[model samples]
Target: MTYCVGVMLESGMIFASDSRTHAGVDNFASFCKLNLFERAGDRVIVLLSSGNLGGTQAVISILRQNGKRPDCPSLWNAESMFDVALLVSDAMRLVDRRDGQHLKKNNNGFHASFILGGQIRGEPPRLFRIYAEGNFIEAGDQTPYFQTGETKYGKPIIDWAITRSTTLNDATKCVLVSFESTMRSNLSVGMPIDLICYKLDSFAVTMRRRFDPDDAYFTTLGKEWSAGTREVFGRLPDLDW
Candidate 1:
């Protein structure tokens, strides 16, 4: 299992994903879950994947290799972010068609999910969550974030703090906090983490980084957040009347 999250805000979007993938206690490994596609001044797209690593990797490879195919609804050619999402979903379905039966015969289902976020030339930034069934839902004003895999542990912070008006920097910070929260609670998710930030109208990724276990900034932020949480908890009035 893994954890991937994306936030679509007024300023732009922020994305983060853990690198851990585990087949079993002894079979754990790290694999990048964040994928990016950029055409300077044209478009910038980020894909956060979770679930069957093989399936998701195959789908991403297909998109990257055939993005220029005239008849293929590739991310680079899609008219809108929504269209790009459809193309991704279609890719998921195609992969499922090819491998689902074999996996199921071995008692494993075709489990994969993705968080697709980015902007095209004329459209505003958008975020979407695509399931294994080849269907997706976009992030909206009321729901401006999406999470895939090991999501529950990190959702509360985003639910409480993320908004359409959130700044790119703040959104990035929030995602880091979310990632820290998830890493603390789940053994299957671990660093180093991949992060990307895109600013509206920029049509390019504004910031990208990989946070290793000893990254000073991340370590400091994690400690600060934990201290703050403890402080807040201490201040809450006791119910022991």
Candidate 2:
């Protein structure tokens, strides 16, 4: 399991994903769930995956391999963000065709989901949530972000804190907060989270970072947030039947 989040704002976008993947609660390993496709000034696309590890790895490998092919539809030749998404969707379906059946037979389905967010030359920045079925929907004003894997616990923070006008920094803060909330309640998601913020029209990632258990900022954030929550709770009146 994983918890990956993407936020789309007027200024740009923010993406983050946990590194932990597990077959069972006792079996935990750190594998980066975030993948980046960068082409300098041409485009900057970020992909965050959650679900069956084998299927996700296979899909990413195929995307990277096909993206280098000139004659085929690849990320390099994608004219717009929409085209980039289609390429990803197609790649996903190809992987599913090859592995989905086998995985199903083994008692696990082709459980893979991705959050695609970034910008390309000649277009405004965009963000999308690509499904395991090779179809996707873009983030719009009404829904300026998307989340995958263990999403429920952290969703409320984004729903309450994010908006189209939110600054890149503020949105990043919100995402960190969301990640903390989810990790507190779920053991499936864990440390060394990857984070990136891309500025609109930059065609390059503006900021990229990672946070682990010992990371100063994350440690401080967790303490402060927990203390704050406690204080707030203490201030509330007790329920009277």
Candidate 3:
């Protein structure tokens, strides 16, 4: 299992994902689910994947390979974040076409999905959640974020703390805390956690970080959040019942 989130705000965007994968407790491993396709001054696209690792990797590989050929439309050539999402959905469909039947024959299913978000030259930053069926929905004013994989454990904090007007720094903290909340409840989702904070029209990713198990800041953040939560709970008025 994994957890990935993309938040689209009035100022910019935030993307994050945990790097844990496993077949079982004894076979735990790490694989980055975050992928970037950037053109420094023109665009910066981030992809956070979930579902079957093999299928996800295959879709990414196809995107990169097809990107190399001028005749093929690719993330690099896409004019808008919407178009980038379409290309991703197309690639997913391609993978399903090629390997879906084979995986099904062996009793496995081709399941993969992505959270695609970023900025292109002429447009503001945008976010989308692309499903396994080659369809997607964009983040809106009412719902400014998208999440995939093991999401339940981490959702409340985001819903409570994030908004279109939230600052990047605060959003980053909220996102990390959500990750902390998730890792605490699910061993399937572990560190190192990858994060990116992109400012509007920057067309570049100047802030990127990865927090491993031993990272000082992440550790402190988790502990403080736990303590704060308990403190808040302690303050709530007791019921007469």
Q: Evaluated with TM-score, which candidate comes out highest?
A: 3
Give lDDT for model 1.
0.89
Mind giving the per-residue lDDT tens digits that candidate 2 earns over 1-241? 7999998899888999999988788789999999999999899989899888888898899889987788878888889889888888887888888888888898877878889988888888888898888789998899999999899999998888799998988788889989998999998889999999998888887599999878999878778877877998999999999
TM-score attained by model 3? 0.96
Order the candidates by TM-score, highest first: 3, 1, 2
Range of the 10 consecutive residues with the lowest summed lDDT in candidate 1: 68-77
Best by lDDT: 3
Worst 10 residues of 2 by lDDT: 219-228
lDDT of 3: 0.94
**lDDT for every model?**
0.89, 0.88, 0.94
- Sort order, lDDT high to low: 3, 1, 2
* Per-prediction backbone clash count: 0, 0, 0
Report the error of model 3 at residue 109, Å.
1.1
Query: What are the per-residue Cα lDDT tens digits for candidate 3 across 72-189?
Result: 8999899899999999999999899999999999898799999999999998899999999989999999999999999999999999999999999999999999999899999999
TM-score (C-alpha) between model 1 and the true structure: 0.95
